[model samples]
Target: MNFSQIAQLLVLGMAPLGAGSYALCRAKARPERFGGAKFHSPSWYYGWYGFLWAFLPPLLLAVASWILRLAGLRPAPDWVLMALAMGLGLAGLVYAHRSVNPELRARNSVEGVIHWTLRMSSVLSILITVGIVSSVLFEALQFFSQVSLWEFLTGTSWSPGTAFLGAAGRETEGVAKPLFGSVPLFAGTFLITAISLLVAVPIGLFAAIFLSEYASLPMRRIFKPALEILAGIPSVVYGFFAAITVSPWVVNTAQALGVRADYTNALSPGLVMGVMIIPFVSSLSDDVLNAVPMSMREGSYALGATTSETIRRVLLPAALPGIVAAVLLAFSRAVGETMIVVMAAGLRPNLTWNPLEGVTTVTVRIVDALVGDQAFDSLETLSAFGLGLVLLVFTLILNVISAYIIRRFRQKYE
Candidate 1:
């Protein structure tokens, strides 16, 4: 059946499920005089039990049919499949209603179903992650077959212009060979990330301190939400603000100081990205600071410490681990950011320390390589996956470190 027809059938199917639930619930909730023993579970458990029975049959059928289709075999006609699904659903509903009685452990049955569902979800997520890693690794191997891993990792140049011709089996010996040295890309990525952290960390940490330790409740409520609202703004919008507003301002300011700066300087995107990452640091840091035991603060105060002294001596140390984790998480976020860098930071793979010079990140280059008309098997195209693998590894390391730090912090605090 078509989408609307299938939707209507599914919606109609829910009617019976809802009716069965309400009927079974009301029946189970009757006075004890009507039954021998107390009801094993609440009335809602029966309702949910019936609902699951009504829903699961059709969903499983649909999934089975989809899998069959993917295997290049048609199991049945759409109408026949729909009929079978509905038939099984109705049968399940009838069976559920018949099974629901005073002696039946409805809660145990429902909880078992829920537990398995959660377990299956976890397994599915792991499978998806494995699949992604496998695909990227396989493609990266293809790219590395043509480009040396050592050169890709250690070389500084990143020109892949002639790689497409090489992929198409053309001679490219005399012409300039494609270089896939990822050092410049990684360097740019780190430079921008570092600049962003410089802008975000201090401001975010100070904001968190004010909100958690110093601000009044009324001011905290207003300012915290306002600060978080910055995170809600889209990256593209931030990129636009950086490009249109921040970039030119940086250029003009640099010129005023007798320093030459590119319009697409690294500093502008870094500053803008830092603003974007402030919420990640501030929100988590504030929570960590607040979670510090009140007794620590009181004890510090009793020791004749001023508020600043108490914060520095007691609260800061207490929350340091969590704050570090927040900063690391924010750094990971800054590393992976694409649009802000794409728009504000020019796509020049410049290996330099100057923030005023234009630089491109791994993400931007990945986007550039994929968006072109180059063949998929081209070294340039496959290079995206190689870059992706590096990015993924870096991100995973940061996450692992963050998790370890948080675990250590919790063990100490809790």
Candidate 2:
């Protein structure tokens, strides 16, 4: 049987053990025990105390067995593991039931268990993040071993058409040089991201400024949710809109203006992606703007400052940090978007500044590599990890810059 089935059986066994132990403990906490002596904790705590003791040991043993098996050590069969967990759980339940009495600190024990459970859950979240980073780094290391970091980062060409699964199969291709250069992919990704930000930041920020400073209570109530509705709409719908509606419009508009444009231009997806990210910037900026102390605005008004000037000088400076953060977040969202780019942007990685032309992004190529009958050990497949690592680093750098800007703004605002 698989690990999940074993876990299900063990959980099923522990449930009965806990119920019986809790019933026994509650019985012991009755008024007849110790001649109606008052208990330190409630009867419920004593019951839960039994429940925790009954479950923890079995859970630990099962986890240990799974870890051992993962480490290439033969632990036991599924039945044996289940039997061991069940036996220990029953033993622990009986002991826990017997140990509970009027003098026992059952409430403290239960509260401590609750606290530790929360602490472990938080730790587990951190560990999961670390594990993901480590796995990506490891795979990227393997990919870089085959392709040099210099070529991957600096070289321009990025076609990894058909890669063999192993070095032994290299002879079939006769020492064929594989180009893993990522400059075009990076260029395309940044081109779309920049266009997305250009469309998102000013429009969203101005919308926030209007909502916070100009709009009345009823207007705020109506417009805020209406604007946020943009965020809730599915990306696939946006992708279809970009492909069908926005792409053609762009092509025709450019043609009417006597310029050439492609059907799958970068501008279409970037514009749609920007519309999707607008609510993020607007919502966060609105919150930050509203949080800027009302007294500051009132003081500026007392000094005969107009609303526009006060907003420009006082509110914007105070709220610059959060606004920067929101813009950076929108930029990241645009860079990481997949469906819209796949639907509206071309697959060809074009390294040009013109948004009128078609371009592909890192996410598009990553999806391209893994969607087909790609070999697990192939160069194309492994390049996805390398792309992911580069994206991770780029995101980290953006976060660092945001943090620095936030800190500097806070120093001045405070």
Candidate 3:
């Protein structure tokens, strides 16, 4: 038998063994309950207690086998392993069923196990996050060992595909030395993000204000969901919309005004991304603005202030923390956006301020590198992890800045 067969047989054995143990424990516990004896816990707890004991030993053995394999231990014969697993499981079942008495605090024991299991699960999540970070850091460190950090940061050239090309995949003849400069990539990312923000912020904020304050209840109900529907649309759909429809329109509009524009310009994706981000700012800002104390609005009205004046002087200031948070969230979404930029924005990686020109982003390059035919250990492949590390740092810095802003805003406003 192979691994899958052994696993299947072990599972099949454990299932019936657990069920039989549960049945036996319940039958034994019931007679004591009907015989006028006080039970410390419910009858089901005894059943679960028996089931766990029967299954847990076998699971531990499997885990131990896996650990041993990882440590280069030879595998035992499949029949021997299967027999050992089944024999231990059956032994556990018999021992646990016999131990289930009225005085056994089976419920407490089960609950304690459940509590530990939940705690372990939470810890596992943290460990998984750590593992991901560690893997990226490790690979990025390897890349930096080959390519300088200063060159990656300051140099403008980013011709990794051509530079890192070779059969042996080393710094051999005909393979140009790699340029890891990330300035163009970061510039394009931020430039698109800046355009997206300019378009999204004012519109989303104003929409939020109108919905939460000015619009009638029925109108608010109708308009709010309609606005949020944009958020529900997939990024691919937005990408296609930008590429096919928006790009040509932008090009034509620029030409009509006697200005030059590329077909795969930055503005198109930026606009579509802005549209994508509208609901993030609008929905959250609306909720935050509404959460501002009603008394504040009443006070502004009592002061003979108009709606606009009240919002400027009272409501907005009070809701600044949440509003800032919403904008930060939108900015992050725009920064991380890939599909829209890949489809709409050109992959030229130009470090320019002009929105009509093409540009590429970190995520675009990361996808390109991973999907290429490069060897797994090659410089081209490892560059993805290096880019990932940079992306991770950028996102972490954004989050930290957002946290500081929120904390300062809360302290001042509260």
TM-score, candidate 2, is 0.83
Superposed by TM-score, candidate 3 places the C-alpha of residue 304 at a distance from the truth, in angstroms, of 6.7
lDDT (tens digit, per residue) of candidate 2 on 217-334? 9999999999999999999999999999999999999999999999989999999998999998999999999999888999999999999999999999999999998998898888
TM-score for every candidate vs. truth?
A: 0.94, 0.83, 0.79
Residues forming the 10-long window of minimal summed lDDT in candidate 1? 26-35
Top of the candidates by TM-score: 1
Provide the lowest-lDDT 10-residue window in model 2. 164-173
User: Model 1: runs farther than 4 Å from truth?
Assistant: 1-12, 15-19, 29-33, 403-411
- Tell me the alpha-carbon RMSD of every candidate: 2.1, 3.6, 4.3
What lDDT tens digits, residue by residue, belong to model 3 across residues 200-319?
999999999999899999999999999999999999999999999999999999999999999999999999999999999999999999998888899899989999999998988889
Model 2 error, position 185 (Å)? 0.8
- After aligning candidate 2 to the native by TM-score, how far in Å is the CA of 368 from where it should be? 1.7
Error of 3 at 184 (Å): 0.7
Candidate 1, 95-118: lDDT as tens digits: 787777787788999899999999
